[model samples]
Target chain A: MTQEVEMKEAQAPPSNSFSSASTPSTLQHLKEIASLIETGAYAKEVRRIVRAVRLTIMLRRKLKAATALAFINFALVQGSEAHAKLSAYLPKEDEHDMDVDTASSASQGFAKHALPEIEIYCYLLVLIFLIDQKRYDEAKACSSASIARLKNINRRTVDVLASRLYFYYSYSHELTNSLDEIRGNLLALHRMATLRRDELGQETLLNLLLRNYLHYNLYDQAEKLRSKAPRFEAHSNQQFCRYLFYLGKIRTIQLEYTDAKESLLQAARKAPVAARGFRIQCNKWAVIVRLLLGEIPERTVFMQKGMQKALTPYFELTNAVRIGDLELFKTVAEKFSSTFSSDRTNNLIVRLRHNVIRTGLRNISISYSRISLSDVAKKLRLDSSNPVADAESIVAKAIRDGAIDATIDHASRWMLSKETGDIYSTNEPQIAFHSRIAFCLNMHNEAVKALRFPPNSHKEKESAEKRRERQQQEQELAKHIAEDDDDDF
Target chain B: MDPRLVEVTQIFGRFKASLLRNDFVTSSNLLSQLKVLLTKFPSLPPSFQRTANAYEELQIAREIYEHAVLLSVKTEDQDAFERDFFQLKPFYADLKGLIPLSPQEYPILGLNLLRLLVQNRIAEFHTELELLSSDALENPCIKHAVELEQSFMEGAYNRVLSARQTVPHETYVYFMDLLAKTVRDEIAGCSEKAYDYLSIADAKTVLMFSSDQDLSNYVTEEHPEWEIKNGCVFFQKAKDSQPCKEIPSLHLINQTLSYARELERIV
Candidate 1:
């Protein structure tokens, strides 16, 4: 132990680090995190421990093999199992780095002992490194081991890291297309999280379960599990966003386009600006849902920053639907069939065919006072042997659905269009006014949501304390691993 | 095997024999008895209570539920079939690793999908379809139901009608026939609106009726509004005698004015 202290003293300078040393700042930041976790464990302040986990996100990106190896050896015990397993996943050098191993975690009570938080953090670090190296098989093995380790731990300080581990565990399994193998395991973990009241873990695992079920197209089971899982205030915005997105997808499949649109839009709005891919996905689904609901999405939705290229196909789809041209819709559907399938929007697009016909019929009704069913069918490009019959039925259904103000004159085989009414004189303007008011009220409520605080909880003198606490919470959100979902593999 | 498991197995065997023999009354009674007796074994789902012969007990219980689902199908009891299928689902879905794959699993799941399609429970049908693995989807029974759903959504009623003859399993035959009826009815509805009048022969072709008797029965019994005269079926559409109901513009304006006044007061 005395020899360890001497060794620590010798290596405590600004420069003399392990061979192939990373930047001094990275080493310094890691040391700060180790100290932070120490202080958090000593004081039993889970917030600080969570904050340390947040700081580790920055450390994760710059974590070279040597840097991670050095940090693990520094933070873990000399011969601990976690230390051995983690470094094994990293590429080792020809020369042994045993000289760096002398830095014991528990020495002279100066540099604190190994906390479970640090160990899980090391596991997270190494898991990320393996995934970055495209060693999914190794990453899968590492994450499962870490999850097993996480199960025995029930501390709130460990919840953040454990939640991250649960995510990576599911991600690794998903990357291997063996997600079904872990369904029971994820369900068990979800149960454990619920019993422990680990809200963050519960949230992440719930989203993972939903993703797992949706991956297989198991909407009934996914809906069942989601409905049965315990509901609580979300502990993380990223997880909440993921939950909303999945919920939107399930609703879309169930043909609840209104609810799907609301949730999908909310998810896009709530997602961090950096999560471009997630936002793009949300927008895509929202656009489709809106189109399915027969409400055209604004051009601005397709013109959002950084989403143009990804959304071009949807934009073209919307254009086809808007034009109400059957041939154009078919061509567009055929052209982007692969993209739609990969996005799982192919099924939703199939349902849009009816909407395309309705729109085309509406446009035709507006332009023509009276037209024969055969001529309408010819215009709509109904390429059937009995275009007149197809057009008659299509027009009747469109009229019944209130897509157009027209009556089917079956006796004459014509669709007689009604003159367009004055919108301002009708109740349409009143309903429009009511909707605008509702929107204003909703915006006001959301603003209040952002501005409200618990009554009488603010102490004037400790306002700084409250501000610091809030800042720490924001910092927790500041470096989310959720952004990786948007990263191109 | 435990004595309790042996009892369940015996009763399950009797239930299966009676169910196959078309004796639903006796089989249902035996099934109820087996359920009550099986509860005594603490090895079923949810708790999966451990015992010496837990695996054997769970396996037997699963088999019993599988038999119960088949019995419900044989009896044509939709409610009972739904209940039994749900009870059997945990065995295939959750406890899959604990037991070997059953041959009946895919066939039963496909039947459930077909039933949902027949019931017009498209939403539930999709939810259930999402649960299947790639291999399960590749099964002929599941693939048959999946293709039918695709054709149904794409408005290929002719394909849906033709699919009736090509059902993959015997149990599927019942749902496929029901599906064919549904498709014919849908086509009938669309045909009445699309055509002012159709010849009796054309009506038969449009509705996929093999005989004129069936078409006449459908027209006379179901659609009494249809008039068959001069050998042509005439759909008597209701004439629009009442003018289009104008939107209650005055009331809506009043409400809108009140809202604006309220807004002014708040401001």
Candidate 2:
């Protein structure tokens, strides 16, 4: 019985294969070997097939089998001491319907199943750790080592290996502003996702690729992928929710507000109740949809709720249109500062808020038409960290890019270049963006023209008061003229 | 005393008495009073200011009132009510400014604004109902008390379809189908529940914008060749375009009402 049990242990597969065709001849030979042992004879045919098939098997699986054999041999060499660590590592009996977090944890050590790949995975793992630590240089170095190690392996083409390479490359360029590397990595991911035959793998890869495109503002590429994404019905509820959310965001960015609202509502309705993080993400998307739809007051309410739920700081900073409450925005900014502990994210949030507040102040110019550009700038400067200093930095950057002429045109609508005349007349966002820059530079007249309608002094109540004052001055001048006529008489 | 508050109080007194008697003059006078209250520094009550939901509802109500005031063309004593409702006009302007005017909203806004005024009327009816219930139905100032009672019941049914939690599918199918049939057949011989059938058709215009699918076929086919536009799903005339074939009669309404129950079972 002990011998039979030992023989059974020797034949167990090192890795699971859902496809029976991938099962090795070693297993078939082991079956014959067991029968031969029962009959007390060597099976020559079984031995031949095993040796021939073993030669064609990849080196990674060979190393895995060899390591496993060495571990089994160690039991004989040291009385189970070598097997002890291996035995304890017997994977926790995996639950089939494991949630995402638990599933990631369960698969954390899956690379160990392939001994050769373990070395490559270890390097990538260390790089991920370095990236998490914000040591981008160290992470890039580790990523280089990982890619080099992968080139050395020269194994059968694995899609996971390709994805990891691009993933690492993408993150390495994130801090360096290396657009070429970033675009290359994203394109690679896009290709890999498209070429992948595995349904689940394709879906997940597409999800990642879509998000990367969105982050880089490559809307055209993202839209092409979005059009091809399968309708979300019949997917796992969690995956369905994510698919709907992405679809909704894509539509929202394209200004298809009504369609986006329907998709987002479906996502919020169906998102997993247990995952607070995902629920908050759905809420954040809703807030974003509302913002795009120009429901400013409602957006403000939703953003505050989103902030309380710790959804994201982006919503808090982006929604500067409704400055009915500033303390709320400030509180959210402070929360983001502590949560991220990254000065980049903190500074980005602060800059976004300052721009929003400035836009709000500019709106006052659009509405009542009394506030001067300098007065608004002074208020913004006092409220903000340093308004003038920031504006100068932007101007310097523009000058360096040789875009000062373009910047000046943005300030004054009347001074629009002949080339820009047609484009500036129709595109509101473009005009606003340039006008915003001009306003920041204190080109008041240019900013006013960029506005929806330049403030008509004749139309305003204050303009009426000005006209009355002018009439009084005119009457005084007439009286003076009459007095001069009497003196002549 | 704040002049606006005193005005509101005086309007409240007259409005309360009229509302008790189901008096239009009283409510119309109260509109002026309500207008004064609305025009005060804070539009809604102080308590509403503290809560987001209340603030939103007040804003919506304020919008409806203002839209009705804009659409008010009749020259009457109730013009004061229109004037009072005018105080709420800024909310509508704000809405118009914020929400880019889609072609669809032009008709729906007018209708919804009308519905908003009707809702205020319903509120006054409720107050009258409460006052009358304190003793008996023969309360002074309530002429055509039976008709008023019937209208109030119809209004209650309206609430079910209008509320947020309302099953939109059911409102579209069963309630609407029943209404169309009752109005088309002029089924005065049927049960009192049949009276609810006609109002459901009138309510469709309000719901038309809410649904993503084109529902015009349901109306056009039923009336055969009728094109209903301007948030008017019910037609007064046959369509100028080619007439669609008449819609098949079915128990679709009953099926719709059961859809929620079916979903509950499956889920």
RMSD of each: 7.9, 36.1
TM-scores of the first chain across all predictions?
Answer: 0.87, 0.35
Error of 1 at A216 (Å): 2.3
lDDT of 1 by residue, B164-260 (tens): 7788888777777778788877777766654568888877876778998998999888899999999889887665334335877787778779667
Q: For each candidate, how many residue pairs have backbone atoms clashing (under 3 Å)? A: 4, 5
Best candidate (score: lDDT):
1
Compose the digit string of candidate 2's lDDT tens values, residues A1-489: 012123223323443433333323433333232232222212323223222222212222322222223222221222333233232322232332222233234334222223333333334334443443356766665565555444444322233333444455555655554433445444544554545442333455465566566554455566787787653334234445666777776665554767877888788777544343455555655655554444553544444432464544545544543552345567766767664332122322332343344344334334432333334335444233444322322222222232322111112111111122343334454446646654544564455567785457554556678789657756755554433222111
Docking model 1 quality class: acceptable
Report iRMS (Å) of candidate 1.
4.9
Worst 10 residues of 2 chain B by lDDT: B187-196
Q: Which RMSD does model 1 reach against the true structure? A: 7.9
Docking class of 2: incorrect
Clashing pairs for predicted structure model 2, backbone only = A411-A446, B174-B253, B179-B197, B225-B239, B226-B239
The sequence of per-residue lDDT tens digits that candidate 1 reaches over residues A410-437 is: 5567888887765565456656778888
Cα RMSD (Å) between model 2 and the true structure? Answer: 36.1
